[model samples]
Every structure is written in structure tokens, then in C-alpha cells.
Target: MEYSKHNIFSKVKDSDEYFLLNPLSMQADILNSVEAQRYKDKRIENQQEYFKKGYLVDPKAEEKLFKSKYLDFIDERDSDEIQLFFTPWYTCNFDCSYCFQDEYTNPDEKVSDAVMDAFFAYIDTQFADRKKYITIFGGEPFLNTPDRRASIQKIIDGANQRNLDIAAVTNGYQLEEFIDILKGARVREIQVTLDGTHEVHDKRRMLKGGKGSFDKITKGIDLLLKEKIPVNLRMVVDKDNIDNLLNLARFAIEKGWTKSPFFKTALGRNYELHHCQTNNKRLFSRIEMYQEIYDLVKTNPEILEFHKPAFSISKFIFENGELPSPLFDSCSGTKTEWAFDYTGKIYSCTATVGNVGDELGTFYPKVDLKQDLIEEWEERDVLSIPECASCNVKLACGGGCAAVAKSRTGKIQSADCRPIKELLELGIGLYSKHEI
Candidate 1:
């Protein structure tokens, strides 16, 4: 048993390969390859500059701050409840193979009003008199076609009437079509996905007609820009798209997407669905992909200023110091969030909805879905988990994305851990050297 000096984990690595917590194991030679050294050095130097500019924080330090701040804010005895996610529809226009919601019945089917009422009622009670952040996500939220859109509008209106913060994650294909509704609805935040460049994005995401959706999606983004809606363009990286990620980043920078109100990149969610497995033939190990991207950004110093919030969070901790709260290395859903399916069934997050045994509980007469979930989340305190406690980077990585872990392993406790761990280390290394 290798105990980490950080006391974050009891045993850093286990006998099972999947349980191994070696950050180095996930690194790709391409990352440290001699040809990449020049870039890596440049990245370090640039990151230091970012630090001077107050652009980053040290991960460990951030963890300490996060925990303390959160603890001070949360009443230990009051049953701290902070976040929730609601997915109105599971039907999406683009079927990327890895969708975890596939297990749910097609979005075409309407969930009984009884379920919606029960679920919302639960939310109303648990968050009584208190404002909370709410996220709207879906297979393709825009697919509600006719009445669905109106229903979604109603949900938003209802939330707004209660004075809640709102956000949504969408595919963006229907963005242009929904501009009026979105503006009128006053959605606080909107996230749209772009997997890679046109070629890479189209390969993984396509329309029902088998046509690529890149063009249409970008057009929607342009529309958002025209509408001045706060937007975040989400890019998911898989093996097929890893090589081009920096290029994608550069593209985002060129379009001024970085400086724009919305822009972020997430590694591909772990798991292979039918179409999402397009990179199967050329799959790079998770560690390889993570390191390559980290290295790419490290060497190309100019891109650091445009780092997405997720990366910025990592850099913040690395450069400034850790916060007290546990970092959310895992899926955000597991710790502070969850996804509610159309039928009112609740899962840990959007990516793990359809997985077996992943349900925390369903909307039912006794469950009190809202209160139950908040209670369940507190019971499963992420910092106390065995796996997270034993890892040195535990504070930095935040126990890995819960959604990714559940999607790949069918259990919330066991998702692919290599990439996230490596990402934290890379971010820390970059931040430590930053001048600020």
C-alpha cells in the first residue's frame, strides 16, 4: 500500500488495473516526446505569465478554500442542499453512440403528468423559499417539436416565477429556430456541443438522414451571437478528435468564441454507444488523450488566456492554491447535480441515466424525489469515498466525473479514472510554474 503524502488516499494504487491511481500511467509519449518539449516549455512559461495576471489558482490550495467556503455557507445540521438537473426530453436529433439516456424509452412517449407533478412537488418542498440553480438538458431539448417546446417554456417560466437561476445543455442544431423562445424565456445560460472540426464533428454527430450537423449547428451559434445570448460552446474530445483538439481550440479563439460569454471543452464521456464509437479503430488510451491535450495547450502558450471554465478552475487551483471543498473531477452530477428523466425517474447525471442499478430513486409517492435526492447526496459525501480518499490528486481531480464513471462502469463508484487524474496533474504542473 503506497500512502500518499497528501493523505488524500490510503492506497494510491490497487491490484486491479482499473483501480490504479498512477497519474503517470495515463501520460502519452507524444506529450513528453522531444518534439513536444519546446511546446511544453512554452506552455509552462506562458502559464506563469497567466499566474501573474491572476488567471490561475493552485489545485490543492483551491481545495482548501472550496471546502472551507462551502462549509461556512452550508449548515452542517440543516441538510445542505444546493443543486439539481432536469431533463425534459430524451429525444435528440443527433444520436451519438454513447448516449446514456438510450435506456429510457424514446422521447416520443409522454410521461404521465402524475410523474411531473410528483417530481416538481418534491422540488418545491425541498428548495422551499430558497433559490437554486436549475439546468435543462435532453436528448435534444428542441425535439419537443410542437407542444414539447411550449411545455419546456412553461417549465422555464415556472422556474423564473420562483426566481431560480437557469441553464441548459443542447445540441445547437435547433438553436436558430428557438432563438425567439430562448430570448423570451430568458434562459440564463445555454451550452451547445461541437465535437471537433466539421469532419470530426460530423463523424460522431449526424442527423437522422445521416447527414453531418456541423454546418447547421454553427449557423445556430452565429444566430446566438446575433441575438447576444450568453452561450457556451461545448466540445467533447474522443480519440478521433484528439489530434485536432488544439486546432479546434484555435478555431474557437479565431472566432473570438473564447472571449465570448460561452465556450468550454470537455473530454469525451467514457463509454461507447453505436455512433459514438466511431473512434473505436483508432482509439487512444484515455491517459494518452488527456496528456496530449494538456501538452498541446501547455506548449501553445497563447491559448491559455482562452481556457474554458473547467480548465480555468484547474489552473486557478494550481496557480493560486487549493480550495476547501472537494474538486469536482468526477461528473458534476454526482456531487452537486443529477438528471431527471422525462418519466420522472432520477439518475446520478445525464450520462448515466439508462445504466442498470444507477437510479438513486424514482419519482414515487413516498420518494419525495427532491428531498430524497438531497438526502442521498449528503449520505454519499464524495470526500469520504474510499477511492477518492486514497488518491494524492483527490482534491484536485474531485473524484472524477460521476457521469463518465457510471456510463463506462455501470456503477457510480467505478468509472475510468486515468484521464481526469492526469488532467489535474497537468493543470497543476502548468499552474505551479505560472508567474502570478
Candidate 2:
């Protein structure tokens, strides 16, 4: 018997105990100093208990287990659910300071009937055997214009004909105008972004003419809540808006949005994607963002009522009382999720959707595929990347974002691993006392 290659051992801060984590088995144990020293010296007292928790295993048996897990991870690529992301137009009404797609020119081109016809035809032929859903993406999908409204209705009508449910990510500027149409369709959930309270949110997410949008967006949100539509409020966090996070959370709670069954919230790091937005320097790293959030939660426990920050390791342990199943890959990319834009171009993920060089193929007007590009994205799992294959924290990091990897290294086959060891250490210190 030998120590498992996947075991991560770390000392618990300010305590004599240590944490033994086996990501493969999703098991964690707190050991006293004596017990930890014994395990380190290969003189464990309870061999049966160690082996049972996957801390120790026969070398031959370990090889078999690794092969099985890796194969199972790969097999998950054959998903039954086909998630299709459709972008109606590239024009957005808001001109946010840190918009990732700010570089994209707003062509304001309409979604022609031929484009819709081709989209449905592609879906019918390619995804007929799979369970399918439509995700309306944009340039603010809910633009309050007759042309945009008609385009949205066309999408809704097409999905309704096939009994497929729809979800949308919109700026929420014109959601009220499209309420009747949305109510008639099979709606799943809609995601809207609110940077902070009125003053902060207005400055960050405002109209192209530089006017504040807080009042309109709030009214739209109220309308959606009244209609009983599920809403996921998202906040893009950076140094500028970090101070106002608690304020926003408190406001949401006071307004009863947090208590609503149809409401949920998430925080996204405002980092650079394809091109850096104006305030790129103000963005926070993963570690920095989590630290700030941890501090916030410590100060005002009531904020937890509005949104529970999913701080990776701590969140997994809090929810399941064990480590999460080791991730073989972080993103779905081209395997499960595909993005189709207004011009019929297909992208591997939403982050790379409108970028010129990242096109996987064209699905409409003709079915032309760049097989080589598609294969690259499909094989971007942790095990496939050379740097990730031998890393101790590969399972935890899941090889990071493929688009970010490509942008940084000029290759999708590389990894953009996060500071997993540091995160694990932080999680151990914060959650050890709360462990079941």
C-alpha cells in the first residue's frame, strides 16, 4: 500500500490539526498532529481506516481506479441535453465601462427570416435525438424596439412550435415592453446584471448616451418579479464597485428580492476577456475577490441571506460535508454548449462567441465546420493539457478557462490554472470549525 497521488495535506492555521483531502474520493479528514506525523512517516496506526478513506491503496489497484475515473469523465461528453445559445443582434443600448464585447461593432443588423429558418433546420437535423433548450443572448436581447421585439418573437415562436423552453441574458432595460410575449412563452430563467446600488450601478451600467439606467432597470426587475419569472441577479465585481457590494446586498434584502423564491444572485469577477475594457486595471484576481467577499461576509452575516458566495472548497464542504467530485475539466466549451451568433457563426463558448478568430464554424446558410478547431476545444480537458497532467492541483483547478488560456498562451491546449493550494489553505482555515 502507498499514499494516493491525489492526497493533499495541509496544516490548519492556528491549530495543531491538519487536513487530509482526497479529491478523487471526495473525502476529507481532520487529523491531530500525532496522527498526521504517523501518516507522513508511513507508520499509520489504523491501516484499515486510511485505506477505506482512499488515503492508502495498492499501486496496481490505484492505476485501475484512475483509469476508470478518467474514462468516466470523458464519457460525460455524450450529454443528452443540447444547450444552444442564440444571439439575436450585436447592438446593445448600454455602454458599460468594462464591457467585454465593447470592441464589437454594433452592426444593428436584423435577424432575417432566412437566418431563423436555417437555425431551426440545423437544430432539427443535428439535435433531433437530444433534449434541446434555447438561451437568448445579446447585446441586450430585450431592446425596446419594434424590429428587435419582432426578432425576439420569431425566436419564441420557433421554440414554442418545438415545445422547447427558453432562457435569456439581458440588460433588463426594456424587459417591461416584452413582458406579454415572455409570459406567453415557456420561460426558464432570465439573468440581469446590477453592478451596485443606484449611484454606483448607474455609473457602471448606463445608456450609450451616458445617462443613468438604474430607475428603468429596477422597474423592469420589479415587473419580472410580479410576473413570477425566475430571475438571477449578477454583479460584476471590481475595485470600484467592491465597497458597494454589501450595500447592494442589503438593498436586495430590504426590497425582499432575496426572500423571493424566484430570485437568486451571483458575483462575477470583472476580468479582461478578448480585449481589455477601459477599467481593466481595476479588476480583481480570483483570490482577491474571494478574500474581499470573505471579509464582507464576516462583517455582515445578514448578507448571507441575499447571496451565498460559492467560495470553491468552502462551498463544496458546506453544501455536501465533503470535497466535491474531482473535476476533469472546468468548462463545457464545444462539447455541451455551443454559441450561434446573428451571422450564423458558431463559437466554442459564450466568451469566444463574437471574436473573429475563434469561430468554430458556420451553422446557417450552410453547415461548414472547421473540424480541427472544434477538435482542439473538445480535447481541452485537464488530462489532455501537458502542464495540467502532472500538476498536483489539476483536479481542483480543472485547467482553468480555455479562452483565457488561449489568450494568454496563444494555444487552447495549455492551462490557466488558479492558485489552488492557496485557496485550499484558506478554505481549511475558514471552514475547519464548521465541518461536520
Candidate 3:
């Protein structure tokens, strides 16, 4: 018998307790330092408890059974909802300092009715039997122009005709003008960004002439809520603006935005995806940012109303009383998500949507696919990654994002490994006290 390679240890916050987690085996236990060391060293005098929780296993038979179960998990997994992203055009009013689309986009490009017709035709036939939704994506979806609003109306109408719901990810500077157009439509939600309070946010997300956009965005949020449309408020945080998040939360509370049932929130970390930016130094790694959130939430519990970071597995276990099944691939890419553009191009996911040379196929004028490339993305998982095979956290991290892996090393099979062990450490420390 030997210690399971899947065992993970983390110390409880402000206590002499430790957490032992085995993600693949779906086992968790609390122990003292000596017990943790004994398990880590595989020096188990009492074999019953060790075997009961999958802490130790027979290297030949049980390990083989576990690997077989993992394969079964991969083959038997289910995805009921498919998300199709439509980037009508990559044009926006906000000249965000970190805008990834500005450098490569055509200033005057716009999708016509012909493109929309072909998109609907293709989507209708291809996904007719599947449950799916349309997501309006772009440089910014709601740009507040007569022509743009007309185009957006057509897109919404097309989806509505097919009984599909829609969601828009926009900057919100011009959302007020489009509220009536979206009224009574099948809108899942309209997502808007607020980096920080007005002063801090305007510095990073501003108009082309360097005008602040905070006032307009917040007013738009109010209008959206007034019209009973759901708004997903997102805050993109980095070293430069993380400190102002609490202030923004207080402002939201004062505005009564937090009291509305139509309002929702998410937090996004500003990290390098396609390429490193000038402000890349301000970025926090996945674990680093969560640690910051952990520290922040400890002092200011009110932040939970604004944004709640999923403290990885610990929080899930704390609430659900169990662990999730193994994740063989975290990148939904071609599996459950697909990105389409008016230019008739197709990409794997949101991260690689507008990127040049990432096109997997064309869906208009002619229908063709680079099946081999799409297959490469579809087959990506921990089993295909060389490093993940030996790593204990592979099931938890799911080998990271394929788009980022390809960008960093030009190989999808190469891993952009997440510090899952480190994240679980922080997670246990942050959420153990709230154990269910």
C-alpha cells in the first residue's frame, strides 16, 4: 500500500487544524499536524481509516481501477446547454487602455443582413436538436447608434424567432438608448463593466478623447434595472484598481443597486491571454488574486454582496457536502462553446475569437472546416497533457485553458498549469469556518 498521489494538504486559518483533500477520489478529512504528517509519509498503522477515505491504495489494482473510472468519467460526461457567441463587429466607443481588439480591427467593418441570415441559417440547422443560447459579443455589443441598434434588433429578432435567449456583454456607456429596443425580448442578461469608482474607472475605461465614462455607465445600469432587465455587473481588477473595489461596493449599496433582484455580479482578473500587455506587471496570477480576495473578504465581509470569489473546491464542499466529479478538460472551446463572426469565420472559444490564424473553419458563402485543428482542440484534456499525467491537481485544474497554453507555448497539449494546491490551501483557510 502507498499514499494516494491525489492527496492535498492545507492548514486551517488561525487554528491548529489541517484539511486533507483528494479531489479525484472525492474524499476530505480534517486532521492535526501529526496526523497530516503521518498520512503524507504513508506511515499508516491503522489501515482501515486510510483505506476507507482513499488515503492509501494498492498501487497495482486500485490505481488501475481509478484510472479506468477517470476514463469512464471522460466518456460519460454530459453538457446540456451550448453557448454560441456572435461578434457582429469589433468596434467600440470606449478606448480602454487594455483593449485587445483595437490594434487588429477594421474601423469601418459592420455586419450586414446577409451575414446575419447565413448565421441564423447555419445555426438553425446545426444546433436544431440541441438546447442552446446566443451571446452577443464584440469590441462592444451596444454602441448606441441608429444603424448599430437596427443591426442589434435584427440579431435579437433572429434569435427570438428560433426561441433562443440572448445575452450582451457591453461597456454600458450607451446602454440607455438600447433599453426600449431590448424591452420584452428574450434577454438573459446584459453584462456591464465597472472597474472601480468613477475616478478610478474612468482612468482605465474611457472614451477616445479621454472623457470619463462612469456617470453614463452607472446611469445606464439604473435605467436597465428600472426597465426590469437583468444586469450582470463585472469588475475587472488588477493591482492598480483592486483597492477601489470596496469603495465601488459602497457606492453600489448607496445607489440601492444591491437590493435589486435583477442585478448580479462577477469578478474578473486582468491577466495575459493572447499576449502580454504594457500593464502586465499589474496582473495577478489566478492564485494570487484569490488570495487577495480572501484577505479582503476577511476584513470587509460586505464585499460578499458585491462579488463572491469561488474559493475553489473548499467552498463547494462547504456548501454541497461533497466534491464535484473530475474535470478532464476545463476549456469548453469546441466542446460546449463556439465563437462565430459576421466575417464567416469560426473559432474555438471567447479567448481566441478575434485572434488571427485561429480560425477553425468558415460557415458562410461556403461551408468548410479544418477538421484536424478542431479535433486537436476537442481532444485536449489532462490525459493528453504530459505534465498533467503526473500532477495530483490535474482533475481540479483540468490542464488550464487551451487558448492560453497555445499562446504561451504554441502547443495546445502543453499546459498552462494552475496552482490548484496553493488555491486549495487558501480556499480551505477562507471557507473552512463556514463549513456546512
Cα displacement (Å) at residue 427, model 1: 2.6
Quote the positional error of residue 84 for candidate 2 in Å.
1.3
Point out the worst 10-residue segment of candidate 3 by lDDT: 71-80
lDDT of 2 at 416: 85
111: Cα error in model 3, Å: 0.6
True-structure Cα RMSD, model 2: 2.0
For model 2, the stretches where C-alpha displacement exceeds 4 angstroms are: 12-17, 37-43, 431-436
Please give the lDDT score for candidate 2: 0.83
lDDT of each: 0.57, 0.83, 0.83
lDDT of 1 by residue, 204-321 (tens): 7788767899898888877887677777776666556666766777777887766766544455534553224434665556556556666766667654654432442354544444
Measured on C-alpha atoms, candidate 3 has an lDDT of 0.83
lDDT of 3 by residue, 94-121 (tens): 8888776766754667888888898898
For candidate 2, the per-residue lDDT at 179 reads 90
**Please, what is the TM-score per model?**
0.71, 0.94, 0.94
Cα misplacement distance, residue 239 of candidate 2 (Å): 1.0
